[model samples]
Target chain A: MRFAATVEVQLRPGIADPEGATIDKAIAALGIAGVSEVRAGRCFRFTVEAEDLASAEEVADSLGERLLSNPVIERHLTTIEALG
Target chain B: MSMRVAVVTFPGTNCEHDAIQGLEAVGAEAVFWWHTETSLDGIDAVVLPGGFAHGDYLRPGAIARFSPVMAAVADFAAQGGPVVGICNGFQVLTEAGLLPGALQKNAQLTFACQPCGLEVAQTSSVLTRGLEIGQHLEIPINHFSGSYVCDEATLASLEANDQVVLRYRQNPNGSVANIAGICNVAGNVVGLMPHPERAISPLLGSSDGLHLLGSLVSSLPAHR
Candidate 1:
C-alpha cells in the first residue's frame, strides 16, 4: 500500500524562533482574521511503501529521528493518512 | 609543567589542525587523538574540535558518539578533567550523553555560517573561568544543526546549577533559551555551538575567542 506521511517539526520552548515570528507577522498583514497565533515549523509529506498504516508510521518515526528532524529543539509528529 | 591537552579527531573532522594550532599558540601541549584510540594518557584536558564528523551522517553526532575516541573522552571527563566540545564536537557530546540537551537544525532551514556573539552566563567551570557573567564576546559558528534544546524540567535544573554558560546575544539559530553553550552537572564538561578557535586571531577579523581558549590555559593549576 502507498501510505502518506505528514511530519510536523517544532522547536523546543525557550528557544528563539525569529523566523516563526516573521511568518506570523506576514500572515497577520494579510488580514485573514481569526488566526491569532502561528509558529514557524517544517512540514514534510512523503509516500512510503508499507504493508499497513502502523508500518508506515514506524518508518515515518524512524525518518524523523534519524534524518527528517532533530530530536533536540525540533519535536516531530508523524501522521499516517487514512485510506481514501 | 604546562597543561597537556589532546585534540580528538573523529573521521571527517576538518578542524583538527586549526584546533591544535590554536592550543599550541597558547602554550598548551596539544596532541592529536584519533577516533580509533581508546586511551588519552597524561592529558589534563581533551578538546573535541569543531568539524563535520562522520559527514554529520545518521543525524548530527549520532554515529560519532560510539567512536573509540569518545570512550577515552568519557573516561577523561569521569576523572574530573575538563572537556571542551566546539561546534560539531558539541553535537557529539550531546549524542554521547556527555552533556545535556541536543542541537537541532536552524528554523529557517538555512546553513548559517557567520560570526556569533554571546554573553557568558556563568564562569565557574574550567572552560569558562576567564569569563564574567553577562560579558560579551564573538566566535565564528558554521553549522546547520546548532539549535540547543532540552525539556522544561532539565532546563530548570540547568538554571539552578548555573550550568548555562553562553547565550546568543542576537539569536542566529532557534536554540532553546538562546543557549549557545552549557556545562555538565559537575561543571567539568562544556559544549558550545560557536567555534572559539576560529576567532582566536584578529586576522580572521576577531580575537574575542582568545578569552575562551585563554581561560583554559589560565585555569590550569601552578603544577599542571
Candidate 2:
C-alpha cells in the first residue's frame, strides 16, 4: 500500500513578500538561479493508502486537480511514500 | 442632463435592483447592465451590487472578474469614473486586481449579516466625497469572506496613500486592521464589505447611509 499527497506554492494575493524577492536576488547574484522571482506558497500532505503506486498516484493527481489546489492560482507537485 | 449610472448584474447577482434603488434614491438615473454586455456607454458611474455570483464558486469573484461587463468597468475606472462595489461586488473588485487585499473566510467561521458601524477613513474617494474624515456611519454587512487580509508592506503603503475608505468601529470579522472598506490609489473605485444599499433609508432604522450615497452625487453628471 502507498500513501501520498500533493503540495502547492503560490503567493497570497495583495501581500508583498520582500523575503521571496530577496532570496531570488541572492540566488541570481550567485549566477545559479534560473528563476527571476520566487513566491512562497503552501503544501498539503494527506494519506491515501492504496494497493499500488499507480493507484496512489491516480488518487493524488485527481485530488490535486479537484480539491487540494485551485488550478487558476496554484501549482502542484506530488510524491508518494509508504506509511508505516 | 440626468446623472446616469449603471448597475451590473452577473449570473447570480441578486442585488442589482437594490443597488439601482439606492442610486435612484440619491437622484441618479440608474439602469441595469448585464455581465454579458461589455460596455457601459453613456453612463457617468457604475455600481456592482452584491449577491452570490456563480454561487460563490471557485473563490468569490474569481470567475466574475473577467466577465465581459468588467471590461467596461475597468475602462470606466481608468477614466476616473466612480465605481462602487458593495459586498460580493467588493469581492469581484479584489479578484479583478482593481483593489488590493483579499477577503478571507471569517475567523469565527460564520456568515455574518447585521448592521455594522464604520468610520470614514478616507474622504477623498469619489465614493466618500463630501464626507468628513473620521466620521462614523452604520452600514449592514452580510458575508462569510468578509475578513480582510494583506501583507504588512502593502497594508502600510495603502495607509500611506490614504486608500482605506472605511474602518469598522468594532472588529467584526477578524479583518486586518478592522478594514471594512477601501479605495484604489486613484480613489475612483471603492470596495467595501458592508452593503450601503441596505442602509440608505430612515425606514431601515439608520439614514446615516444616505450621507455616503449623497457623496456620490458630488459633481456627478445630471440624470439621463
Candidate 3:
C-alpha cells in the first residue's frame, strides 16, 4: 500500500519558542487585535510504501521520533492517509 | 610524544582549520578525519569543531549525527578516549546521543557573535581538567540556536555528578542554570557552545582558550 504522511514538529510546551514569539509580536504590529499565542513549527510530507495503513502510520511515527524531531526539546505528531 | 587529536569534519563544517591550529598551538598534533571514515586508527582524542553541518538542515547537527564517523567516535569515547564538541559540534553530540540535553533557538531569536564570559564549573572533565573552579575565561560564542535545555531530573543528576563543566557568567543564550558546557558522566565526553579556537591569541583579544585546550592535551593518556 502507498500512504502519504505529514509530520508536524513543534517545541515541547514550557520550552522557549523565540521564533514564535517574534511572529506574535509582528502580528500585533500589523494592527491586529485578539491574536495571541502564535507558535511556529515545521511540517514534513512524504510518501511511504507499506503493507497496510497501520504499517504506514508506524513508519511515519518512527521517522518523526528518530529523524524528524529531537525528543529532548521537540515533539511530533504524524498523520497518514492512504493514497488511492 | 604529543597527543594525536582527530578533528572530524562533516559537510558544511567550517571550523576544522581553526581547531587544528588551536590544538597545534597547544602542542597537540591535529589531523583531519572526514565524516565518511569509519575507523579512528591510532587517534588518541577527537574534536568536533563548530559549523553548520549539513547546512543545519532539519535542525543543527541532526543530519550530521548519522555520518559514519560518529560510530567510530562513539566507540572511541566508550573506551574512555577524550571527545570534545564545540558549538555546532556540541549540537551534534546531543543529537548523536553521546551527550545529554539539546540546544534550542536563542531566547531572543537573534544570532549572537560576541566574546562571552564563562566560569569553570568543574575540573574533572577532559576540557577543564587544568582549570580551577570558579575561574572565568573569555570565549566567543557564535550561533542562532545555542540555548541549552534538559529535563529537571537530568539537570539534578548532572549537578550531582559534577558533569557541568562550564557556566556562563552572564547567561548569554538563556541556557538553564547558565550552563555553557557539560561533560558526560564518565568525564570523557564534553560539549560546549563557546568557540575556544577563536580566542587562542592575545591579538585575538584573549588567550584564555589555551587553558582549556592545554588541559585536554595534558589529560590524554600516555599509551594511546
Candidate 4:
C-alpha cells in the first residue's frame, strides 16, 4: 500500500519567533488591523510505500523525530493517509 | 611534526580556505577534508569552518550534519580530540547533537555581520585554554541564524559545568544570556558563532581571534 504523509514542524511554545514577529509587523504596516499575531513553521509532504497506513504513519513519525524536526526546539506533527 | 588540523568542507562551505590559511598562520598544518569522508586518520584536531553548508537549506546546518564525515567527527570528539566549530559549523555541531542548544534567526530578523566583543567565560575549554576568564576579544560574526537558544535547565547545567566559554559583551543577535559560545561537558568540543579564522591577521581587521584559535592549538596533546 502507498500512503501520503504530511509533516508539520513548528518551534516550541515560548521560543521567540523573530521571523513570525516580523511578518506580523508587516501585516500591521499594511493596515491589516485586528490581526493579533502570526507564527511561522514548515510543512513537508511525501509519499511512502508501506504495508499499511499504520506502518506508514510509523515511518513518518520516525522520520519526523530523526530528521524533519529538531527535538530540542521544534515539535513535529505527522499525518498519514491512504493513497488510492 | 606539526599538528594536523582537518578543516572539513561541505559542499557549500566557503571558509575552508580561510580556515586553512589561518591555521597555517598559527603554525599548525591544516588540510581540507571532504564531507563524505568517513574517518579522519592522522588528523590531530578538527575545525569545521564557516559558510552556508548545503546552502543553509532546510535550516542552517540541518542537512550538513547528516554528511558521512559527521560520524567520524562525532567519533573523533568522543575520544577527546579537540574540535572547534565556528559560525555555521557551530550550527552543524548543535544539529548533529554533539552540542546542546540551537541557533535561531537573529531577533531582528536581519543578517548581522560585524566585529563584536566577547568575554571569556571559561578558562579550561580546549578553545580557551590559553585565555583568562573575563579577558575580552573582538571577533566577527556573520549570519542570520546566530541567536542562540536553549532550555533553562540546559543553561543552568552549562553555567554549573563552566561550559559557557564565551559571552557577547554587547549582544548583537539577542542570544539568551548573550551566549556567544559553549562547549560539551568534556570541553573537547566547542561551538561558537564568531569567526576566529577571519580575525586572525591584523590586516584583516582585528587579530583578537588568534588568541582563541591559538589557545585551541595549545590544548592539543604534544605527541599527537
Candidate 4 docks at the CAPRI level of: high
Error of 4 at B22 (Å): 1.0
Model 3 pairs in collision: none
Q: Model 4: runs farther than 4 Å from truth?
A: B222-224
Q: Write model 2 residue lDDT over B86-181, tens digit each, in one string.
A: 889999898887888777777545688888989999888877888999998988988988888777787999999999999999988888889999
**Residue lDDT tens for model 4, B16-83:** 99989888887888999999999999998999999999999998899999899999999999889999
**TM-score of each model, paired residue for residue:** 0.75, 0.75, 0.99, 0.97
- Candidate 2 docking class: incorrect
Q: Rate the local accuracy (lDDT) of all candidates.
A: 0.83, 0.80, 0.94, 0.92
Score chain B of each candidate by TM-score. Answer: 0.96, 0.96, 0.98, 0.97
Find the 10 residues in a row with the least total lDDT in model 2 chain B: B215-224
Q: What is the lDDT of residue B141 in candidate 3?
A: 94
Docking class of 1: incorrect
lDDT of 3 by residue, B59-115 (tens): 999999999999998988888999999999999999999999999999988898999
After superposing candidate 1, which stretches have Cα over 4 Å from the reference? A1-84, B221-224
- Model 1, B1-224: lDDT tens digits are 77788898988999989888888777788899889988887888888998888888756888898788888888778877889999999999998889988887676757889988889999987778888888999888898878777888889999999999999999887887889999998777999988888887889878888788878866763223
Per-residue lDDT of B112 in model 3? 87
**Which candidate gets the maximum DockQ versus the true structure?**
3
For model 1 chain A, give the 10-residue run with minimal summed lDDT.
A11-20
Ranking of all candidate structures by their lDDT, best first: 3, 4, 1, 2
Error of 3 at B113 (Å): 0.6
Q: How does the DockQ of candidate 1 come out?
A: 0.22
